[model samples]
Target: MSRKIREGLLMLISIVLLATGGTILYRQLLPSSAVKADGAKSGGQLSVRHAPEPKADVQGRFPAQSVERYAFSQEGKDLFSLLVARYQDSIGLPQSAVLFPKDAQEIASSPTGLRHDIWQSAADIIARKAPENALFLSWWDDGQRIHYLSGKEAWLRKPSDKTFVGPVWKALQDSLPVASDEERARLAQMARWLTMDSEKALSEIAAHFGASRPVYLLVNNDLLLHLAEFTAYGGTSLSLDSKNIPAGNDLHGDIALVKRWAFEAGDGNYLAQKEGNYYRVWSTPDAKAKNTLLVRLLPFIDSLKKLPKGVSLVYQSHWGGFLSVYKIDNQPIH
Candidate 1:
């Protein structure tokens, strides 16, 4: 009731209020996960920020050469093209999606025989615009090695001699319901290589996997080896073979043979017989080729001294994809 008592009570209440406010402010400044909830839902409120999607430059696989230009030349450019069109137009089939039923069915019908052009087109598009974080699909390659590439690496694999393509036939069976005699024959052939040797299969397949991206570049062993060396040593530098070719155990089985084969193949720039340990500028009509080549050579120049006697070398240059070669210093020049 007294004025001094009234003033004293008001001051005490203000001090309590200040203490409460300060406690809240300190909690707010605490690191997330450190802050305790005051009877809030599941701990506390989560501050969410809708970040803009990463503006990454997407890349896709482009056909290095037309289907008609390679080994399947005589089939007529239209033959394989027509096949792709039929697969695309088929009912209950998928146009382009990883492990889609339609794609599986198409593989079932023609296990070792896919339209290369269509595959390349689909692959390129998928690389450029990745709709998902991961993609998985079983593929067949007859006895021929399947080659898939992405970013800086390439994979080569040959299916077992007896595995039939399962998904393809499953799709076909789903749509056709009743298989004609010819369809049955195709199905049988597709499943011929179904069972696999788990050990060898796993070991061989494991080499192709990459940490950053999934495998995409698929080709036969011959083509795969050719491309690997091309991409590995900056598009087949001239120096790779010239210096290291002589210092091997055997001519046929030595590193020299690898170099020779690479050169004999297309874009044999792996043997860069240049005077300096630097890459040369080079270009190709094929963007995939150019990119692979560039990434391969950028490392060799920096580590030239440590290069193995039997190893290949690709150097970097001012321009892209061009290569330079050097031999190991202690290699026996036989």
Candidate 2:
């Protein structure tokens, strides 16, 4: 097989899930209906399976060894660390990737999680832009990173009423008991808040914070191999489209390849971070999906030429996995 073809196939197979709490993430093979056999297999049928479960019950669920602290930066005291969960492989097995600083550069992008450097850099952005009293409304994970790295206050610790089980396991998930804390429940609504209509989402945010203090909306890159927590909690679905773009004799070929992927996905709203010659494209063909906050918030994937009204970009990291902070404008997106 050609190198390009081989890499595409591996990406198709290597896709995995998020390891937060009871989150079970796995990328299902794209349906055969859209298969393009020119140089592809598995019939081009890539669908996202979002299965987020129980909250991060560190003491109760995961073993001590499963969770470890990694000192990813020099900015912190001595060994300022972030708790990482290493649970399950591509097949829902118990095995996980127990990595060290040495592996940061190697496995630090999409299809994988952030590396030590990326974490520190993202934290640095928060430290610089975010004011001391600014309120952060993002996923719990980002909140923790913000609190740890920037020393800014974020509602990241109070275990949310087990991040709402994804669409696939709604019945079973609803059965799982949830804590009745209002703030926790509000936090749990992050899924709907993120994936819903932009206007309504903004309105909700306004209502929640009510100008009591400064609020910054934080989002990260969507080019992850695992089932993104945002899509899972929001029950959003999209096909996982993998491609092997030949970089030709230069970088121009690579750039063109990414552009083509964007065109195919109804604009640049559904792109995944490219991995060498391989690109994991998230295909959004529907109207509802086309208007989601997840797509618009992503830097390169946004369909707009520039950020629209009411949405201002505060910081965009060179690496998508790193966080992006946005300040809400009083006006609504037009």
Candidate 3:
């Protein structure tokens, strides 16, 4: 080979060797964080925190009484117990179930066995109603502290509470006024959003709730009663004469009806729990479902302050009833 040709070949080999060494050095020296930081510094890439996988059953199953005991004051406990019994299984009842009697005085006179059965039935109903992706369970520690057995560390306090309160917390007090001003504001917005055209509502709901989860417009009125007429089924028999079971009647009735109508009748038009993206139009004269609905709505509606103007949120009612419409830009019930 000529000297010039040999020199050219040597230069080419040197370039290749240099390129290979630089590539290997870059891979070895650059940590993931360093790369991410450098990319961010360039204003082109983003860094995200990767959450760890959740552990199973971390808090385990807490007893209903434990939650009641921890979350409530003595008076609250008494009132809550009565409230639970009055509504029976909570979700599976006509609005009229609340009117069987008024006030805690009436519940105190009721039988213990009846109350126990109602409490158990209500827990079962809640478990059934809770979504697989969402947090489910009725009871908490007596101090109103919530601990879960799965995913991350077990004990969780409500995000809004500043104290980081936990460990033998008191049960939430009873006769707690429903719907704070902030809640009312959001609900008013929600109501107005519902008042929009059905097509609008449907589209908004599909977008916000995703295609998977069911939506609900819960209320305390005849509407839920009608829906509950459809949910009652599969509860343990209350007594030899089914009418005597005040404890399990509310939920059982729903299980029974759902079994009969939702499946047996095979009515596609009638909404049932079996379907995804269904609506729950819960209403009850006693207002347990209504109260529960309000409680659930609190944190969710708080998030609405961040929503863009004219962007309405819509929920689908599982049980067809009064809460179906959105209350748009209207006065909230004080």
Candidate 4:
């Protein structure tokens, strides 16, 4: 062979050897699952063995029955903590990923139960539309579910973070049967603050947390129904007398002393009269003489309709408008 051809052959041999060695090293560094084992001979053919099913780490873990029993126990703090931690680790998720299963289950099983599906729908919408770090502002009662399902931080994470309740109460007080436009304006201002969409409202909310961040507001039909409890009317327990007044009772004299207010309900106008046990509301003007509890709640209900200019209703559920999502347009205040 020529000397030049011999040298070229030697170089080609070196290149082949280097490539084989590099491939071997790469295989050795791969994960165990990536490495294949020698196959068994079956019917004159090599058959590769299927990967073994991974054995779950059952050690130091409670059985399914124990978990179920613990779920029903009164002192389940430890169990809940453990389950929440395990769920996070296993799913590679944050604490907000775990729905407040206990509360959701309880509500589902109640007589006046909320349909869990509705909550899931709302959560889905929030998760899709809300920014990653958005901080939700809502009644403290809804904090847990919002945090868990939406995977977002809530302003009212605990009962103690309910500083907004005072302002809400004041707004409710202003909403009472007073005949002053100034009182109504004050009530409107408080509503804006509670919704946290205006500059003043944002400043007040930021003061509580010591910083400002993106915020979203969630509302539902239950919120409308129980508006009084979230306002000044909620401060005192309501009681009713056993005496039933006639349907044609003089509302100005008999019912006006308690509370009387009108509000828009759906397409029609309605009046609420609250006196003693006779808390009744009706759309028909003929039923105006009857007393109702809804009378005191008209202001709060009306406030729900008056969102700030930049706040827009982005989502509404089909189920009796039970779920609503409002988005605040982030813009510089002129």
Error of 3 at 309 (Å): 25
lDDT for predicted candidate 2 compared with the true structure: 0.45
Supply the global lDDT for candidate 4.
0.35
Error of 3 at 321 (Å): 9.6
TM-score-best of 3 and 4:
4
RMSD of model 2 against the true structure: 13.9
> Worst 10-residue stretch by lDDT in candidate 3?
236-245
* lDDT ranking, best first: 2, 4, 1, 3
Residue 248 error, candidate 2, Å:
5.4
Between the candidate structures 1 and 2, which one is better when assessed by TM-score? 2
Predicted candidate 4 versus true structure: per-residue lDDT over 166-257, tens digit per residue: 32222122111232445334343334444322444545545644435566666653433333333442222222111222323453443332
Tens-digit lDDT string for candidate 2 (1-334): 7867765553332222111111101222212233121222232332222222223323212232344433321112121122344443223444222222323334222223344455566666667766667877776655544554455666543333344332212212322223347656655577667776666677777787777777778776532332355455443553434454443444445545555675785554444444433444454556666565655665434433345446677665544323567787632112
lDDT of 1 by residue, 216-296 (tens): 222221122122223232223222222312223342343234334444543433322111121111222232332332223
Model 3 RMSD, rounded to 1 decimal? 29.1
Question: Model 3 over residues 1-334: C-alpha lDDT tens digits?
Answer: 7867765564343222222211010011112222121112322222211111222211222322111111111212221221211111123421101001122223332222232333333334333443444321111110011112111111111211211122111112231223345544433434333233334544564465554533333222221111211122111111100011112334445434433432332321122211111112111222222122222222111111232232232322221111221222221111
Which pairs of residues collide in candidate 2? 17-25, 30-45, 30-46, 31-45, 35-43, 46-239, 46-240, 111-224, 111-225
User: Of 1 and 4, which scores higher on lDDT?
Assistant: 4
Candidate with the greatest TM-score versus the true structure: 2
Residue 256 Cα positional deviation in candidate 3, in Å, after optimal superposition: 29
